[model samples]
Target chain A: MSELLHRRTVVKELLKKRGDMVVIGGLGAPAWDITAAGDHDNNFPLWGAMGAAAMIGLGLALAQPKRRVLVVTGDGEMLMALGALATIAVQKPKNLSIVVLDNEHYGETGMQRTHTGYGVDMAGMAKAAGFARTMNITAQKDVLRLRPLIDGMRGPLFAQVKIDAEKLPLVLPPREASYIKNRMRISILGPEAALHQ
Target chain B: MTTVSKAAKPAARAAARRPRVAAPRPAPAAPKPVMPAGTSHWAEQVHPMLVEAGIRQVGLVPDAGHSRLIQLCEADKSMRIVRLTTEEEGVALLAGAWLGGEKGVLLMQSSGVGNCINMLSLPVACSMPLLILVTMRGDHGEFNAAQVPMGDSTQAVLEAVGVLVKRADIAADVPEMVSSGLRLAFNTFRPVAILIGQRVSGAKDFRKLTQPAGDINE
Candidate 1:
């Protein structure tokens, strides 16, 4: 009902001063948003794999339990893989957090209305799926509140932040998937382990 | 002609003398080759093989043929098993695991292959090592017609997505195929799928399942 928060600003705040946190962006706009925040080796923004951001976060969380894992995705991408919510709940990775930038429309597909636009509740679904914590963040001020939870919250935390549906300029990540993967691998695992692939 | 006849007569006389000792009885029929009694499922054999390969994460959508392997992975303290709601999640999950410096495997059935088609691109494009162990459902005496299409198409579909496909038609060959597939995937940073043929992992017979417990003929 009120003015929606800007997606880029929200992403910038979430990823500000990110240290060793593994960030996965869902396909399309979320990928662009994370790239807009700042393209770092730690950031793996998907050029594709529409519904897989959360599951990737879950795997990273499980693999490196000490490092925080964050997934930022759009409402459409999240809807495509709702079952991943259940899977993440069962795994209960304490280091994992998922943030949905709910624009209520498929921003990439010409702004067609998605289920979120018709009143689907992403946070409620996550809560019901047994996330340790869930939130529906609609206010700009609340964006600041998510930083601490993402960094240290006893997680499997889920948050659905409603963003404006207005299309913004694209901030693209590396086009080569191999380059993206290897760069992150080198950053996290060092050249010795990341070499070859 | 006289010399040739004489040589033939001597050779025939020697053979008759050697065998006249009494016709040796035919050797007793060798027993049919059969697996040892109480042998465990091939998945049991493959579980340890996975551990040996340094597989730290396992993403799985449960299958009857993989039941033993899943149980083994769950019990092992060193391994982490994530149960997927659909087979496709494993694709992304394993990719993430590799990014975090861990080796992961995916376990699914043949029908689940369709669910993973689009997601397979993640590994292909990224050149991440992905090893998938598939238990076939619709081959070799398949009872459920619904599984046929995907089961038959599993190899072709995976191959089309740039995955190297292998098959294990006999239980004895399953562990070896899995080992080779793992090596091929991880060493080369390629996506590999090993199809566990229905012959090796028996197909689920719906008719037998629907029958009452006491009505089972076997």
Candidate 2:
């Protein structure tokens, strides 16, 4: 078995050179991971909506076809809405990339073993669903390879990056959903197109 | 010999037999003809309305009632039709569309509403403009008992999740109702649902299709 890479390090590396990319962090740890990397106006981290990160990425990708859209989610969150993989594959937006930070455990719910821990393959599911690109990263060196896929890959891509399930200090993003939403809209579409006046 | 007639409840049958006498109305001096004829296909009217309203992304889970509308949407070059595996994904998808400055809507049947309940929190919390078109089942002419519970609770369920619910029972009224719903949702940035009732969408009668094609024992 390969050594597990740290989730925060991988997220930071992915977003280090992220230029104008729209990022959707799935609920819980993935949300914290992206926030920990850096809080930006373009980052729309989920405070709730557990299984919706990738689907949200699909919508954003389709809506903003020119901008790269990344969904940084956990394995548990990915497992909850595995059907989204099929939905996204059918759409096939070139700008979309989903990275599941597989910690093997449901980190938020007292670290119980998730489907991924019991050998459910997230990347395999995406490949089966017809994603153009799929990656399984279990080593630190492979984390760097994922950066180009997030930045410039011609893909509706999916990557399951195996990370250590070690609990880390919370790095919370803005809890107000409206604020987060409008902030992202202003950043992407300017205030004129922002919702709720 | 026909089981379809037997399927209707006695009270409903009695109401259908009663003659409906509508009150007389005065004619307008000038009729502004923005709407199509009352007999126009509801989906036909709705498809253009959505396009005109600047709906750029359409997320849908296939339903028999909205099949024509889905086809129309798919054919529209300007709109991107996203086929969702389940209805809940559409809720999040529309939210993402709004975040990216594009308007989107979700089309699904009443049964899919149950799948969307948890995800509805995302839109409700963010106050994203979510427009949903739900084709009802189990209401007037339904043959399936399984679809009844969700159909009956669809409006109440949507309303409970802070979604403004509107029902169009008459086919002619669907276009206007949907137009108003579009305004209410986009303008106010609220989650709004337009429930196309079984009367408007037409209930499914499986008995007609299930009738013996020929003598099976032959």
Using lDDT, give the best candidate's number: 1
Q: lDDT values of the candidates?
A: 0.90, 0.89
Give one clash count per candidate, in the order shown.
0, 0
Give the DockQ (2 decimals) of all models. Answer: 0.59, 0.80
Q: Which tens-of-lDDT digit does each residue in A1-197 have in candidate 1? A: 68989999999999999989889999999999999999999999998888989988988888889999999999999999999999999989899999999989988888899998889998999999999999999998889999899898499999999998888889999899999988988998889867854
Global lDDT of model 1:
0.90
For candidate 2, give the docking quality class from DockQ.
Answer: high
- In model 2, the runs with Cα more than 4 Å from the true position are A195-197, B1-39, B212-218
Error of 1 at B100 (Å): 0.5
Q: After superposition, how far is residue B101 of candidate 1 from its true place, in Å?
A: 0.9
The C-alpha TM-scores of every prediction are 0.90, 0.89
Q: Judged by TM-score, which candidate is best?
A: 1
Provide the lowest-lDDT 10-residue window in model 1 chain A: A188-197
Per-residue lDDT tens digits for candidate 2, residues B1-218, read 74555557787788887868874586764322223456557888889999999999999999988988998998999999898889999999999898888899899998999999989999999988899999998776688999899888898899998999998887778899999999999888899999988776566566666768663322
| lDDT minimum window of 10 residues, candidate 2 chain A | A188-197
